[model samples]
Target: MSAEQGTHTHHDDRATVARHAVAADAAALDQAQRTASPIAGRAAGAPSGLDAAYATQHALIARRTDRGERVVGVKLGFTSRAKAEQMGVADVILGTLTDAMGVDDHGRYDPRTAIHPRVEPEVAYLLGPGVEDELAEPDPSASIAAVAPALEVIDSRYRDFRFSLDDVVADNASAAAFAIGPWRRPADTGPMDNRAVSLEFDGRLVQAGSTAAILGDPGRAIAAARRLAGRHGFALRAGMILLAGAATAAVPLPATGVVGAEIAGLGRVSLRVGDGARTEAR
Candidate 1:
């Protein structure tokens, strides 16, 4: 093929990929939503890398937004080097959080509506006005208004909870639901490193670890988000929450019970789970 023909073919291929990604992402999300079933993983047609994967994620989030799901914040995933290496991903990734995905501070979760629910503990960052402006780089400390204990609910659409990096990214990092505790200024959680994080399901310790498990310090995840979001032509914005990646491995959500997390300096946050439906605490 001639140079001009090759250029045209390349552009056409890009457009085709974009269209296919949109359709595939929408199908995956829609199926996951309707029946609470774990759909098949994207294999041969999955995006090639982080950029392409995020493009597909944006498409999926856009569909949610179109359906009136307001973007509430962002969540970081795989921030721990161990997790990244285990998952075979080169770096940490992000996912969009919608207001609809929020479980209030002490909300109740219904496992039946959630496909393969699992939870993780984390230190949440409340961004300030500084992030709204166009800065070359955001200072995690400067942008942080407060910190809190957070619990992230994750449910992968991929069958059997297995997926390639691109598949997980395209699934918006498996964001399902999240809750945050009372916020405290950074001073309250002084030097947030190695702080203990433990989760209990129905009064039994299900997962345990320290903040150090999350990329040494959860603050680094915020910094990474700040830098990364800017490259995508956006800002984190004030009033938006950022759930620094999970500090410990996720544990399956009990069929029906109260699940709680105790973060050494951040105090406790809990969610009650039912078999059929969910209720938010006012």
Candidate 2:
């Protein structure tokens, strides 16, 4: 055969190898999920589970993509030092985007679909412009413009609501759904400044926290998010929602309960959890 023909054959072989690698990764993840067995970096005493977690998230994203779902954006979690400590980790993790994760402003969420669902009050940022460059410069302010108060609903498929950092990472940081509030434009305020927030369940106050709880300032969490995305060759884009991690510990959502969050400068967002709806455990 001619040299061009040999090159084509080599290319085909490489493509086949790549396909098998991807298939093997997917099969491993499927086995892990089914048997509740930790794989790769998720194993006990692993330094961090970021790799294993990202792999699993990528698998899920690929599956969604195969089903024709558009990826809207990414979400960051565990930015709060307190939360990291609570989860026994130092850094944050990322989750893939999906249309189904969006909840209507006043919609009801069922608790049956989630393995273990939990609620966290947070401040989310909607990128008005693309941050492709800023994601690499090691500073978050250059890429972000506005911020908003929001809540993240997280759930993990693992049993007992307990898992190692790698396990959680492999599980997409336990992110299930999110509810966002009105945008606080021109987030010129310092990224590290503290802002008070209150959460109410069924019209009664249940918890209160400060944005400072999240990596000293919610903006820093945004910066961390940008950095994390950069590591994965992705950028925070315009109109994409960036969840700056939870401001306080996540709360367990019981079936048939109404949840509300009020950020000092940002407005309020509320949602109802219904029976048969799935939720993450705190």
Candidate 3:
């Protein structure tokens, strides 16, 4: 039934159909995260447009906040042409980040709350005020206070990490957990777009790339974040962070293993996950 219907279905109107579709999709997503299990994607006639999908995602996050989860910041997706091509889309997307989705650096993370979790190294931005100005100039550093080596834990709510582009968008861009190393002043991590990053799993190099791959410059991703999120009444607040998308393809995170990353000059960041037998760390 449409959100307006408040109930009833079977021969539901188009608007009602969309409402029921979005509600079911959001419920499935929330349940997936709670049980750390994957679910099937939305059916072909469900909320399949980006605008409609994002509206559902925003509502999902709002429900979490109502339950006491504090918003921490935001993150960008499809920051590279390759990623856009892979997804059959041409625009980058933004997702909400929350304090509850953070794992301490150098500390243990619970692998129990994720289904086929994966990790990717990325450049993270610590925001300052006036980001709107920088976004206007298409220059992200002017509004960034610092940079850090970050690791993002992404868990697709869909089975086997399989989903259509719209499905992923509705799933909050696959965001899960995140950790960042010591923050460094812009002087140290100058020209973020050119930094080199590498990810090592259990001490073996697994993925590596340059930030340039992120929309030609990681900064542009931030600009995109500001513009896109602004439409939803979000502002670039100081102290907020922005995970500038993956530098390379994500690597499967094992139940028990060390995940570490290095950025050219931002220093190192890492997290450990114990045997998957545990269930409360999240």
Candidate 4:
């Protein structure tokens, strides 16, 4: 074969390998989610880099979108500096959120929907129209229409919830489900930073934290999301929800009970598990 022929053949071979790897990763994760069973043994085909990991993530989320689940927003992970430090990473991660993942306030979050689920407190932002235009501005949080108290359920598809950064990224940041309370105008909510936060299981306080734990201010998460979305070549449409990273450590979701999170001045949001269920300083 000529030299040009060999180069083309090698390129095609690499492309084929990448496609196969992404398909396998997506299939494994999809099956685990659908069966509510965690997979053991991270295989050789698992994504080994950020690009491959995110490709797997997109393919995984695409499976649900193809099944009619609409993407409603995005969720961030490891936004807390302390948590990032703990994880030995310098940056945060993000995951897509679909309509299927949202549990209404006071709505039930079926434990059978996830594998080894855990819950954490978060601050959610509602984006306004033209928000995408603000992504490059000095303050991207200016795109926020409102803020709310929220909870995110994380269930790693991997056994024992053990995985590397790339592994978790490929699993959609371990995102399983989420719930948001009534929206409060950002003006009415006061500073996004330093809001007292708490999570309760059946009226028993399970965890407590502050919105300041979310990258020093939950609003900053929007900026991070904007950059990440742009880097991934996805648009952040108006009306999309952004769940800032957890403000407190996650606790295992109870088999059955009411899990609630309250943000000072923002109000409260809750999820009912079969019952129901961070770190920081940016």
Candidate 5:
């Protein structure tokens, strides 16, 4: 083929690949939205297929980012060894952040938009300043200095609460929406390495755990978030809220329930989950 023809062919090939990637991403999002279980591989009988389902997830986040959606922060998942082993995965996964997914210190949420929704007691951190690329190493102290305590509300869009590691990763680490508590400055506490936490449902203690539940320390989770963001060509910014992985197994909320979580140093955040009810800020 002539030079001009070769150039045109290359451009066409690039376009075709881009189109396929976008289509795959959209289909994955649709499956999550519809609560449909995506085929494990390309086909029912096919042995080897897509190796990384989260690639489609990354594409979905990219599309949103391209559309001027600011990434508020990152979320860490599968931090506990027990949870990781149960999920049949060795390492944890990360998810991107969006403004629309955030809830105030005292806010409410609807259950209709989520599939297999559950609430996890966690310690969230708010970054004080942006962490640039060069300084993105896994420094727990520096990362912790940029963190604050809060809670996270997670809801999966998977059918029957069933999914493989790839499936969950593609579903944004099963994150639908999250709620933050009153921010507690890291400096206020002296060496909060392994503090204990408790979660109460309707004024009754439901679950208890420690910061050590998250990779020995919540700071490590923050470091993981930093590394993950850097790998994705992004940086953790000031005012960003990072939901460290769950301190304990997620507690499944019934259709109608009042949930509240209390961190050691941080204040408490409460929310009401209901079916077909609008979320009212408390």
Candidate 6:
């Protein structure tokens, strides 16, 4: 074979290998989600590089969509330095959020199907139409329809809630469920930075921090989401909700109790925890 032709063939072979790896990783994660079983992190059928991991992520989300789950938006993870340290991952990651993953404000969060669940406080953004274009400009505030105090319930599919960066990315950033509070116009919420954020379980404060922990300001998470989405070839659409990552390290979700999150100016949002599996809260 000619030198250039040989190089082209080598690239094609690598692409084929990555494609098969992505498919295998996606299928393993889908099985784990369905059976509520924890697979060995990275040690099992996980793709190697970030690119393959993201491809696996999209494939995993495709499985959910095939089963009738609509993609509602995207979520940024590891935006908080502390959360990244806790997870042993330094880079930021994004995950797909589907309609089936949302819980109404004040609704019950049943964790029966989760392997090990945790809850964290967050700032959420409601995006308007043409968000993709607006986010490309110097200031993207115009594309933000509203902001809210939010909570995310993350349940890693890996055993013991352990995984490497690529493993978690392929597993869709451990997205299990989420809740958002009342929406307030962006103009009314100030800059959405420096707001006191806290998570309470059964009326007791368990985790506390500030919105500033979310990539300096929660609004910055929106920009980060846009960039990550573009990198993954995912489009940001109108009426989509953007979770800006946790303000504090997540705490174990209770078995049967009210789990709430509050942002100083944005008000509070909560979910009633349901113990469908009779597993005790950690």
lDDT for each of the candidates? 0.82, 0.69, 0.82, 0.86, 0.67, 0.85
Q: Give the TM-score of candidate 3.
A: 0.87
Candidate 6 yields a Cα-based lDDT of 0.85
lDDT of 2 by residue, 1-282 (tens): 999999999999876765555445555544554354545433332223355456556765676678676777778877877667887787778776567777765567776666557888888876655466652553566556677777788876565677777666656667778887766665544444588888878777788988888777777766677778767545467778788777777888767777888877667787778964333222
lDDT of 1 by residue, 163-274 (tens): 8887887888899999898899998779888899999876678889999988788888777787678654334789999999898898888787778888996788888888
Poorest stretch of ten by lDDT in candidate 3: 273-282
lDDT by residue (tens digit), candidate 6, 78-135 = 9988768877776789999999999998887878778899999988888876476843
Model 4 pairs in collision? 247-278, 248-278, 256-275, 257-275, 257-276, 273-276
Best-first order by TM-score: 4, 6, 1, 3, 5, 2
How far residue 216's Cα lies from its native spot in candidate 6, in Å, is 1.3
Off by over 4 Å in 2: 1-49, 134-139, 187-192, 275-282
Off by over 4 Å in 4: 41-43, 275-282
Question: What tens-digit string does per-residue lDDT give for candidate 4 at 158-242?
Answer: 9998888888888999999999999989888788789899998888898988988899988788778888988875568889999
Task: Write down the TM-score of every candidate.
Answer: 0.90, 0.78, 0.87, 0.94, 0.80, 0.91
lDDT (10s digit) by residue, model 3, range 167-279: 88788899999999898888766677788888987777899898888888887876788888876555568789899899888888878878889888678898988754222
CA displacement after TM-score superposition, residue 138 of candidate 4 (Å): 5.2
Tell me, by TM-score, which candidate is best. Answer: 4
Candidate 5 RMSD to the real structure: 4.6
Between candidates 2 and 3, the lDDT winner:
3
Please give the distance, in angstroms, between residue 176's alpha carbon in candidate 6 and its true position after superposition.
0.5
Measure candidate 4: CA RMSD.
4.4
Give the higher-TM-score candidate: 2 or 3: 3
lDDT, residue 270, candidate 2: 75
